[model samples]
Target: MKLAYFPGCSLHSSGRDYDKSIRMVLGKLGVDLVEIPDWNCCGATSAHVTDENLAVLLPARNLAIAEGMGLDILAPCSACHQRLVIAEEELKKEKFQKALKETTGKEFAGKIRTLGILEVLMGKVGPEAIEKEIKTPLKGFKVASYYGCLIARIPRVKTFDDRENPTSMDRLVDLTGAEAVDWPFKADCCGASFGITQKPFFHKLSGRLLDGAGDFGAQAIVTVCPFCQLNLEMAGYKEAKETPSRTPLPVMSITQWLALAMGFTAKQAGLSSLLVEPGRLRETVSR
Candidate 1:
């Protein structure tokens, strides 16, 4: 279970809960995550389309740092995973590799392998291992597993599964003895930066996810990325200016749910870090 873990900038800042929950749950599973020393930003939302060289170099520097450790990079954030994976793919090409080498002073050999923590949990740890550790199964829970654009999107560059209705996360949720609900807006975008910029857009989008979850009688909606969590959870604050009444649905990172299923303390899973008040819905999930 030893892997090079990259938490990206957001995890340390606005998304510390994602990092906390991940480390806590993975620790309970006996997984060793060694952080990449001196790791830089993955340039997730901004750099790619705006600054060409930065898009490659930003992730290239992180990839090179991971390469130095001689371990595969395990990124919990889907955006970071996508960016790093894209960097690995693009840097392997001749023109991009030349630019990366010029900026980083090290020729990236593409030895750096990137993985979403979800991938490791589902495929590496497998459903059986997760099931073995479940102390309180979510027997009655009908959950909507939200896989945002980055992890499964971006074509063959960062993609490893069917982008349309990828079932790994949903299956993992189901293996915890819960019913993976066929909620609408499963493959729909949750309006990432539009959460701040074009917030009105994702308000409707986030509400759609919430409406779908509520309609299916889901206990909670689970996601792997902080951006998705923010977009869905923080919608009302911004969207209220336009159209209000956004449902305050609880969106837990998969790590939070896993730790809860394993019967770990809420403190251990950083469940207290959630913005949405899930306490009211305890009976819905814990029954």
Candidate 2:
């Protein structure tokens, strides 16, 4: 199967590990990814706040390009997936359609669909297919599947899993032979960009998530959003430093974990770039 891949801004920059793992794992699953050419930022977090039309148009252009390619889009980042899905919904309205045409000189045929990585993994490539490719099952590892806010919180748009209690990522983690701990913060906010704008509040929110995961006996926190991973790692790092007895929970992108189980090296999955290393998880994988 082939799809148009949109790495968005974060995946190309802060979320490189996610991009690497998604490409590698999907390639291993016999799925081909054709990147959207000349793709721009999806206007996540900032664009919609400043200018709604600009936010819609930003992803609409990418959607138009993907529509021309006649392939569904696989946007790995949660924010990107949400933004693209929002644009698709907006395009259904005549005003947004006219705006898109006036701005980009292109027509949106609404011929394709935008999917998050979870949707692609669970819907397109089932866990059974992935199970067949696993070379090193993470049999005893325990992780918390963090979904953050954007992936499934959009009320109007249809999401693959339950909005409040998502199990898609948990199921994927379980397929790796790792146990996805039943934790309360799965769909909670990860304090997002607040880590930069409002440090204290970000710490408080992210700290609660880390504390919750740790209390539930989670060895690591797995996520699908770059901001979530970054924020959680940042919070975990500071928390560990503040309290010597506390160990920083390794925050990993779900694709990175899948890549490890599929026999890819840590370097190949960009694990070295993470602020909090998965030392214990690495040992378990080696064993």
Candidate 3:
């Protein structure tokens, strides 16, 4: 399978782990990911809150590029996936489509579809195929698969699993021989960028997620979004303020976990790059 990969901004920087492991895992699965040239930020919340036209046009530029590549856009970042998909839907409107073409001097056929990495993994690469690729099953491991928001909220937008209680990530976890605990807050919002502008609010929202994962007896929290991973990692510090102190539960990308099961080294899978380190969990998996 060939896909036009859009790493977005965060995936290239703070979310490098998601990028690396996804590339490695996809390569192992015989999937070729062609990076989109000259891709820019999807504008995320900023462009939407600022200028209406900019929001549509910003992601439309990348969509046009992906359309040219003649492949679906595989965006790992939840924000990028949501924005790109939303922009594709918006561009269907004659006004937005005409405006976009006038501004960029390019006609977007709305042909390029934006898909989250989870969708590609669970949908394109079936769980059976993934199970076959696993060299080291995550035996005795237990985790809460956290989907956060963006990926599963809107029913109109194409999503991998249920909007409320997504099990795509959970099933993927099961494929590696890990127990995906039936934990709450699977679709809960982590306050997204609110973690930056409002620390107290961010902590309150993220703290609940962290505390819930521990309360459910999970050893770690598996995530697909970088913002969710970052917020949950920050919550490791703030969680003590609310609940009884416990060992910091590692917040990691789903791809990172899969990479480990697929026999990739810790460094190769970008496990070392996580803010809330998974060293203890890695040691446990090794033994």
Best TM-score among the predictions, by candidate number: 2
lDDT of 1 by residue, 1-287 (tens): 78899998878977888888888877877789999998888888899869977888898888887788888889988889888887888886898888877877866787759989778888777777778889877676678888888778876663556788788888888877788888656768888888888857877888787777777877688888888887787863344445545445678888888777877666666656667667654544443
Model 3: runs farther than 4 Å from truth? 238-245
Q: How does candidate 1 score on lDDT?
A: 0.79
> Cα lDDT for residue 90, model 3?
90
lDDT of 2 by residue, 1-287 (tens): 99999998888888888888999999999899999999999989899989989889999999999999999999988899999998999899999999988989988978999998999999999888989999988888898999999899886877998899999999989999989999888999889888999988998899899999999999989999998998999988887788878788899899999999999887787878988878877766654
Q: Poorest 10 consecutive residues of model 3 by lDDT?
A: 237-246
Worst 10 residues of 1 by lDDT: 236-245
lDDT of 2 at 62: 98
Q: Count the backbone clashes (under 3 Å) in each candidate.
A: 0, 0, 0
For model 2 the TM-score comes to 0.97
All candidates in order of TM-score, best leading: 2, 3, 1
Report clash pairs, candidate 1.
none
> For candidate 1, what is the TM-score?
0.91
Structural similarity to truth (TM-score) of each candidate: 0.91, 0.97, 0.95
What lDDT score belongs to each candidate, Candidate 1 first?
0.79, 0.90, 0.86
